[model samples]
Target: MKKLINNFTYITFLGYIAFIPSGPYPISVFGIKLDILLGLVLLVLILPKITQIGKNYPSIFLISLLFYLVTTLLSVIFSEDIVFSTSKWFSMLGYILVSILAPIAIDNYSKIKFSRLFLLVVAVVISFFIIHMALSYGLDKPQRFYLGFDPTAPANYQSDSGVEDIVDPNMTAIGLTLSVIVYLPNFFDSHHTKRRKTLEILAFAIITFGAFLTLSRTAILSFSLSLVLAFTMLSISSKSIQNILTQISKLFCLLLLVMIFLFGIYTLSPSFINGFFARIENIESGKEDRTDLISDTLSIFFSDNKNILFGQGYHITNPHNEFLRNLTSSGIFSLIAFLFFLYTLYFCILKKIKGNYWRYFSALSIYIYIYS
Candidate 1:
């Protein structure tokens, strides 16, 4: 019985990874839609080891999460649409559940094999998506998939990022960035054969290729910053020659990946490089929608004293900035809770983890902040 439960746990994690890239999430048990990943994660948390997992997580993070949940509930009570607010609150809870459970589930001791399998699965999914996008670009059938969103919407046309069956292209980029951070380092550290590393490098390269196709400035900028940060952090922390060489190899591989990305763009779509630059041009010229979004959100935020404290409500929809979105939707209390939660996760929980785990987590945190 115990062995069966462990097998189920591992299978659950694999299923979650498989579902991540493209999700309609149409499955629901009761009336509540099950977040497949979080559902599996929660199952993993049900074991006897769950107590230790809880203890392993930072106390500050747990406190902040509690506060955040309370604030979300309060926001729902005061919200215009209770249904929407309630749904969002539950979703946030799922996210927190997954975040806390993931580190515990993939920790160094018992579940390390599951962790490797999860990474490999994610890497394969990313590779498949990159191949699909390349074919889509070459054939020029549909510009972008825009999955789970209205294709005919004006906003769809405004954003040139390659969404490719993901809810949002920017989100796709963020996911890919995270996969790169986690797996790329392993490519360096793994004592796998030359052929195996080549395959891994191809996967990483393809992931990078997908990121460029998104043309998401935030994604690109955040990924760049995270790489530099990861490199610097790894370098400073390592005194062993093997560790230092591993860091250097990661940097070299990254640079090579960029070169391959540029060449791929030129070969596949010669004008893509220009389009990417045009996007930057628009941002620089203050023509980007995000600029106006920030301005308008700030105006609404300060428009009323009540909103300044409680928030404009979740239905406002277009904040485009994560912190501001939380501020405008949930309220100042939620925002404070959120900031504290992030601080604790990165500074406390991530820092407490030994080995290259911290490097990957730090990169992920940086990506989340920038993508937000």
Candidate 2:
């Protein structure tokens, strides 16, 4: 019965991951969002075994998490709108709980293997679904997939009325980004059969194409940086020149194949390519830039002495940068706590990279850091 419950908990956790991209969509039950619902269910399932779960995690991780949670809660007292801040605080708590508890449920080698396979399957499914939807009903004016959103609706109409479901392309891209990062190394693994390698390559191509459709610069940049960093780490860890040369050859071949695939996409949809380049051009031209927002966020963060300690509170503003967001939402202490938590978490994952199955987790940790 205990084993059965753990398996169920792990499956629920995977469901949470699968729906992470759909977070902004208005899919709900009894007015509760699906992701929140899954999280709540997961919390309930684990509560009975909370002590057991807690025992598995490191002391530093738990201590940092607790401190982070406490700081966020404390920030709520200083919020201008207590009700809204309280709601946001609860949401943050859910995310923290999910992050800490979900992976602990995947205890052994079998679960680790299955989790990777599940994420790969999810990546392929998401890519196919988004690409098919985009091709069939057509992309929005921005040539981006507006999945779970009413493409015809005005931005203000969707935002003000709160009736139309909205899906942020950037968030959707993040899901694909994670999926790609987690399974990308498999393509280079020599243990796989030829057929398996071919399938993995196909999946990678489809997912990469889907990520392109989102046209999220952050997602694209994160994926690129993570891939480069992952390879660099692998190369550094390699014991011999022959192994390093082999990695380089594989990377070159992969890049060539990706280029050809992208060329094929451009031939099929020149407009899409144009749109993507236009986005890049806009960013380069400062027409669609975050520098101003980030600048303003910094100003607000340091405006008052009280804000320096307790922050302005939740739902204050979207800083877009996680560190800035934390600094603005819960002040310096929360930021410190967050940094500590991240350090411990990354350190833990770093230690596990020596194991074969843990490499994917290490890659994921790198991807999350870059993405953030």
Candidate 3:
């Protein structure tokens, strides 16, 4: 039984890398309409003894999460659509519960290394998808369902499900950025072999290219922020002024190369530049209505101050932002609990995690979640 659970744990870890749900549409297989990877992760967490793999979490964090869950449950009870609210609540609860067990599933440093390798493999797979999509676009061909490819859009489009094997383009871009970020530090690690460094560089370039093809402004912005934060962390952690200067020089050189490359592309393709800039211009002009949506969310929150305690009861779905979604969906109480839990979790991860990779990953994961 333990062996079976162990196998499932490894499978789930690999699934997270290879099959993260990202498509605008979900692919169904054998009548299963949900994310297979997430499902496997749920199972890993459910199996006896699997949850014991990681260090114990803080009692306060657990208590806060429980409080948040209770608030969510109360919101569901008062929800206009009880059935839908309940379903969504359970789904979110399951994800949160299972994710807490991720470190348990990994269980060791070796497993973490394997997970990074798995991520690299996934990056290679994404490169293929990017290439295929680029070819299709260049040929002016219709989207191929088999490739899980969608045309580039200025913003995230609401879709019922994502395709199999390929994630949504925006999510794909985010994932690619995550891969690049994880490896970025290692690329500069002087202790690594020449061959390894070469591979790391290639991987970074490929994943960055994939992100470029996605054309997702949110992903791009978030990725850029993560890079900045990562460099800041590195600089702060350095022991000497010389180390700081070295890091700064490396960052500057990398940015210069990227800028030069982008400039070259802009000069070479006038139409592409016009189209891309036009999308940015549209965003600047507030054509996306996101600001209006945020305004509406604020109005909803203030219209009934009583709702601040118990929320609007799950019927209001389009918050357009995570903080508003938490506030209006589960009330101010839940939002506070959630924020506290996040703070505790981040603190614990930074203090307890043994490896650099996992530490960076935890920070990046939280940043991605809040932004997403």
Candidate 4:
């Protein structure tokens, strides 16, 4: 039984890694969307071994979530498209619940370590593809030597689902950045070999520079922030500092190599660079600022009667900002509960003497959650 659970863990983690760039669109496999994350979440939550069926949560939270769920049902009842609203509401809730529950279920360091390895493997695979994409297609269209081999977006346009949302150069760049930066916490541990450490840092630089090639203001900003937050979150013991300096030297060497790669990319493909520059012009025009979406979200939030406690059932589920998206979707009660969860996580990792990569992951995960 334990071995089965262990197998389930690896399968779920690998499935998550596979799904990230796999268009998140449901493919009709036996007439169903082959979404592994949703399936695993259901499996874990339902398996009596995964969670205690009658285990108590605070009544206050239960009552609040129940009330909000009812309100969401009301929204669906009043919605112009009942089916859309119902599906969207449940889908959004399921996502929030999974993220919370995944970490909660890891009962020990071994599980956390296993989870980190899963994410790290994903990072390496994504880094290689990002490198290939930069060299061959340069994010103009995201082609490569392997996998879905076409210099076009993976998403099939006919679906009209959000997956069909254009895989813009910046979005591709951001996806690669997620692959690298998510592993930042793994760097500090002495367990990572010198060569492995250098490779990870190199991957981060290439991914970041490739993001620059897309000229995506958000990607650039997010990478810069992810980096800054990483340094801010690091512990500065003398030995740690010395070890980090050693890693930094290797990191710099890796960056130089990527710089050479960038030069080759530019000389070989001016069109990709031109496209990147075009995105820069759009940024200056305030296109990336998302002013319209911001205005709409604020207007809806303020106009609603929901208090901090309940938040009008988080009426605006699809807010442009990720944090705001959650803020207005899960009652403020849920938001705060999650925020407290994040704070406890970050504090445990950043300040607590016993903290390790798991804690650091929790910290950065929260940061990415809010800001990404």
Cα lDDT listed for each candidate: 0.62, 0.72, 0.63, 0.53
Candidate 3's C-alpha runs over 4 A off are 21-25, 37-46, 50-55, 139-168, 183-191, 233-239, 284-287, 314-316, 354-369
- Residues 1-372, candidate 2, lDDT per residue (tens digit)? 988988788888777767744324556688777777888999888665566655777777778878888887877888767798999998878777666666565667667666666777877776776788678766535556655545444333365545546567777777776766665445456788999988877887887888788787878777766665666667767889997887678668756886798798888888887888788777735645777878888898899977888788865657778888889878999899889888877766666565663375346445464535
lDDT of 4 by residue, 143-193 (tens): 322223333544343334433333444455555566555555566667889
Rank the candidate models, highest TM-score first.
2, 3, 1, 4
Clashes of each: 0, 0, 8, 2
Model 1, span 1-372: residue lDDT tens: 967866666666655554443332234445444455446455545445556755786677778778877876777777767788777777666656665665665554436544554655575575466556556545233243233334223333433444322356666666666666655445555567999788876776666666666566666777777776667666777788887888788778767867777877777666777777677677735556677777888887788876766676654445666788878877788789878777776666346555555445455545454534
Backbone clashes in model 3, listed as residue pairs? 22-168, 23-162, 23-168, 24-161, 25-161, 25-162, 26-161, 26-162
- Candidate 3 residue lDDT tens string, 291-338: 777777777777776567767775455655667887887688878877
Error of 2 at 301 (Å): 1.7
Candidate order by decreasing lDDT? 2, 3, 1, 4
The number of the candidate with the highest TM-score is 2
List where candidate 1 sits over 4 angstroms from the true fold: 23-54, 102-110, 113-117, 126-130, 136-142, 145-166, 233-253, 284-288, 314-316, 355-372
Q: How accurate is candidate 3 locally (lDDT)?
A: 0.63
Model 4 TM-score is: 0.64
Cα lDDT of model 4 overall?
A: 0.53
